[model samples]
Target: MSYMNLIKEKDYLKILIAGVINRFGDSIDAIAMTWLVYSVSQNASLTALNFGINFVPTVLIQPFAGAYVEKLNHKKILVFMDLLRGVVVFLIALLTYFQCIEGWMIIVATFLLSTAEAFRMPANNALTPVIVKKENFNEAISLQSSMFRLSELIGTGVAGIIIGLCGVHVAIAIDALSFFFSGSIILMVKAKSYLRIEHQNKIFTDFKKGIKYLFHTKCLMRICLIGTIVNALLVPINSLETVLCIEVYHMGAELLSLMGIFSTIGSIVGAFIYPYLAKRYTERQFIVSFLLTMSLFYFICILNKVFLNLIFLFYIHLIISYFSLGAGAAVLSTYSSVNLLDKVDESFLARVSAVCVSLCTAAVPLCSFLVSFLSTFINVSDVFIVIAILSLLLAVLYSIISKKRWLE
Candidate 1:
C-alpha cells in the first residue's frame, strides 16, 4: 500500500496526528531550551552539558525500561509518560516565569524530560508494529518523518519570533501544552496491548536477555554499532548550534530560528525521497549516502565560517548547508528505524529495541563532553571540520569492512 492508504487506517492516523502536534512543540522547545542555557551560563561547555544530559537516561535506564514495557500496556506507558513530562516541563516554565530557575534546575529538567523519553522510546518501538502491518513499516515511518520535519520547520521558524517577543517561558509552556494534547490523543487510539505475560521473568532477567540477544545478533549489533558512531558524530554539531549562533554569528533567537527552519526543510526533503531511494537501492546504499552526506553537512560547517566574514554569503551558505545536514539526518534515521523495527519480533520488541537504542545512543553524552572540552582549545567551527573528516573516514572504513555479509 502507498503512504495514503497507510494513512487511511484510523488508529494509525491518530498516532500520526498526535506525533505532529508533539513534535511541533518539541521543535520550539529545542531552540528555547538551548538558548536559555547559553544565556544563563554564557559558557559553551555548560550549554553542551545541558544537551548531553538529555541522553543520560538513555544509557542508564532504557534497558530496564524496555524490559518493564514488555509486560505492560505500551499505550498506557506512552500516555503516562507524556502526561508526566507535561507536568515536569510546565513546572520548569513556571519556575522560569517566577524567576527562580537555576542552571542545575535546567539540567534537571532536561534529565527528567529525557527520562520520560527513555520510557517512551521502548514503548513506542514495541507499539508501532501493533498499529501497522509489517510491510507498511517503511511507508508509515517515512510519512511520520516528513510530517515531523514540516512541523519542525514551522515551529522553529516561529520559535525565534516567540522567544524574541514572549520569552523562553512562553515557548516552554507551549511544549507543555503539546505534551498534554499528545497524551490525550494517544489515549483514544484503540490497540491490542500485551498487558500481562504468564510466568514473566523478573525485570533484571528480562533486561539481561535483551542484552544477550543483542550481543548474539550480528546484524543487530552491527546496526547498533553503526548508529552509535553516526549519532556521536552528529551530536557535537547539533549540540553547539546555540554557541554557534551566539558566538560566531553574533545573532540571537531570530537567527537560530532561521537556521532551524532551513535545516528542517532538509529533513522534509530527505523523508519524502526515502521511499523512492529505498525502491532502487539496498540498505547499505542508503547508509553509504548517509555517511557521505552527513560529512558534507559538517564540511559545510567549515564553509559557514568563511561566509561569516561576508554577511550575505553566510545566510546563503547556511540555508544550503543546514538543508543538506537535515536531509542526511532524516534519511539515515528513517531507514535505520524501519530496519530496526523490521528485524525484531513483537514478543520482546520493547526490550530488543531498547537495548538497540541504548547501544546506539551510548556515545552521545561523551560526544557532547568532547565538544565542551575541544571548544576550550579550538574554535567550534574547527570542531565541525574535525568531525567532517572523522565522518568521511568512517564512511570509507565502513564501506570497506561491510563489503560482504553486511548491510547489503
Candidate 2:
C-alpha cells in the first residue's frame, strides 16, 4: 500500500512504457483530424465547431468523472475507457476508409471520444500518486508530459507520410491501434487496488458534497480558479493559432510544426529544472511569475507581427510562447494535489477531478466562439493582445490573493 516504493527505477519504467504507448497513438491526430474536418466541410466554422463540441463534454462531465473515479476502481475505469476509445476511433477509421466520413460523424465521434477522455483523465491524474513515490510525482508527470510531446514530434512526421500516401483513414487506424497498445501496457502494470470509498448517500447528494467541498476550501478553490482562468483566457489563442499563421502571416503547417518542436524541447528542459526550482519557491509564486513572463511574451509576439515579415518573427514568437507555456505547465503539475487532493476521500476523486475538468474546459468553446466571431472584424494581432491582457490580469490577481497560502 505504500506509494513511496513505486518511485523505484523499475516501477517508473513501467509507467514510462505505458505513457509512451498511450502518447504514440494519441499523437496521430495532431494534424490529421483537423485536416480531415476541413477536407469534409471546407468550412472553417464547421472545423471550429468540431473542435468545440469535444470540449462541451469536458465542461459537462469532468466533475462527475472525478467523483466517479474516487468511488470506483481507477485501473478498471482506465481499462474500460481505453477499450471504448479504441472501438470508437476504429469506427471512425472505417468511415474514413469508405469515403463516407461526414462532418456530423466527425463531430459525434469527437464528442464520444472526449466524453471517454473525460472519464479517463481524472483516474490517470490521481493514480500517479498511488503508484509513484510522492517525491517523484513531479518527475513522473513531466516525463509523462514529455512523452506526449515527444510522441507528437514523431507522430506528426509519421502522420504526414501516412496522410500523404494512404490518407487519413490509415492514420486514424494507427491511432486506434495506439489505444490498444496503451491499454495492454496498463493492464500489465501491477499496482495496489484503487477502490472507491463507499458512500451511503444518494449520488446527487454525493455530487453536491464534492462540489461544495471544492468551493469551500480556500486553497483548493484558488488552485482551481487559477487553472480555470488560464485555460479560459488562453484557449482562444491556441484555437486561432493556425488561422493566424495562415491568414494573417501567410505561413503554413511546416512552421507550426517547428513551433511544436520548440515547445516540446522547452518542456523537456523545464521538467528537468522545475523540481530544483520548487525547492526554492512556492508554487503560487512560480505560477504568478511565469504567467507574467509569458503574458508579456505573448504581447510581444502579437506586436512583432505588425512590423516584421511573418517568416522572420513567427518562429521566434512561437518558440517563446510555447516555451513559456511548457515551463509553466511543468511547475503546475508538480503541485497537482494542492487543495482538494488529501481533503477528499478516495471515493470522490473522480467527481472532484470532473469538476476541475469542467471548470478548466468549460470556457474553451466560448473562447473558440469568440475567436471565430472576433476574427470577422479584428485582425489576429488584436485577438492575441486581448488574450495576453486577460492572462496578465488574472496572473496578477491570483498572485496577490494567494500569496499567504502559496505553497499550501
Candidate 3:
C-alpha cells in the first residue's frame, strides 16, 4: 500500500500521530535531560548515569510489564502511560524552575518516565498488528519509523534554539505538554479489543512462556543476542556524544543539537527507504549487510585524528557514520517488528515483545557505566574505537551465522 492509503486508515493514523508527538517530546527531553545532568554534576560519569537510568527500568521491569500488558487493554495502557509520564515531566519542570532539581532527582525522574515506557511499548507494539492489515504491515511499520525519525529530526533541530533562548526547564515543560497532546490523540483511535488472550495466565507463567518462545525460536534468539551486544556497545557512545561535543570538540548546545539533527536526518532517510528494501532482500541478508556497512562506517569515524585539522572533513565523516548507522538501525527494527508479528501468536505478542525489548537493553546500564569509568582511565576516543572493533567482529560473525535460513 502507498503512504497515502496507510494514513487514510483511521486507527493507524491516530497511532502514528500519537507516536510522532511522543517521540518528538522524547527527543527534546533527551537533550534537556543530558544537559541538565551534566550541568548540575559536571561529571561525565553522572551524565552517563543519567542516560543509563532511562534503560534500567526497561531491563528490570519490562519482562513482567509485558505479561500485564497482555492482561490490560492496550488503549488504556497507552493513555495511562501518557498521562503518568506527563505528570512526571511536569513535576520535573517545576522542580527545575524552583532550582531544587539535583542530579539524583533527574535520575529518579528518568526512572519513573522509563517505567511508564516499559509498559507502553509492548502494548503499542502489540496494537500495531491489530490496526494494520497483514499485507500492509511492512509499509505501515516503515512509515511509522519514518515519522518517528522525522519527529526526532525536527525536535533535535529545534531543541538547541529552545535551550539557548528559554532554558532547559522550558524545553522540559514543552515535552510535558506534548505528552498531553499525545494522550489526547490516542484517545481518538477507535480500535476494538487489543488483547487477544481470552483467559489470562499468571504473570510469572506468562513471562515464562514468553521466555520459552524466545529461546525456542532460533532466528529470533540470534537476532536478540546480536542486538543486545550491539546496543550495549553503541549506547554508551551515543550517551557520551554531548561530552564529546562540549568537552572534546569545544562546541556548545547548538553544535550538539546540530549533530543530533544530522544523525536523525540519516535515520529518516533510512526509515523512508526500508519498505522498498524489505521487498528486495531477505531479513537475514538485509540485517547482515546493514550491520557490516554500519561497522565499516564506525571504524572510519575513529580515524578522525588523521584529518583533525579539517573540521569540515570531520563533520562529513561523522554525518556519514551517523547516516549509515541510523539507516541500519531502522532496517533492523522494521525487520524485527514484522518478524515478531509473523512468529508469535497474538495472545503472546505483548509479553514476547516486552521480553525482547528487555533482553536487548539489558546490558545498556553496564556499558554506560563502563564508558564513564573507562573514559577516566583511557581516552574517550580509544573507548569508542574498542566499541567499533567489537561491532565489526559481531557483524562478521552474524554474516557467517546468517547463512542458515533461520528467518525462512
Best by TM-score: 1
Better of 1 and 2 by lDDT: 1
Q: Model 3, range 1-408, lDDT digits (tens) per residue? A: 477778567898999999899889988988888888888887877887777878999999999999988887899889989999999999999999899999889888999999999999999988888888877777787788889999998999899999999999999998999899999999888887376566767999999999998889886786676567557756755788777667666667887787778778877877778777777887667666665766676566567656658988988887777777777777777677767777777778888889988998988987887777887787656776787677678778877776766645
Runs in model 3 with CA error above 4 Å? Answer: 293-302, 305-309, 404-408
Order the numbered candidates by lDDT, best leading.
Answer: 1, 3, 2
> After TM-score superposition, what is the CA distance of residue 64 in candidate 2 from its true location, in Å?
2.0
- Greater lDDT among 2 and 3 belongs to 3
Q: lDDT score of model 1?
A: 0.86
Worst 10 residues of 1 by lDDT: 399-408
Candidate 1 on 1-408: residue-level lDDT in tens?
288778557888888888999999999999998888887888888888888889899988998999988898889999999999999989989998998988999999899999999999899878788888888888889998999899999999999999999999999999999999999999998978554668779999999988888887777877787688678978987789888887767778998899899889999998888888777887666677778887888787667767776888888888888888788778778777877888877776899989888878989988888888887788777888888888899889878877866544
Candidate 1 global TM-score = 0.95
| Candidate 3 weakest ten by summed lDDT | 297-306
RMSD of each: 1.7, 3.6, 2.1
Candidate number with the higher TM-score (1 or 2): 1
lDDT of each: 0.86, 0.69, 0.81
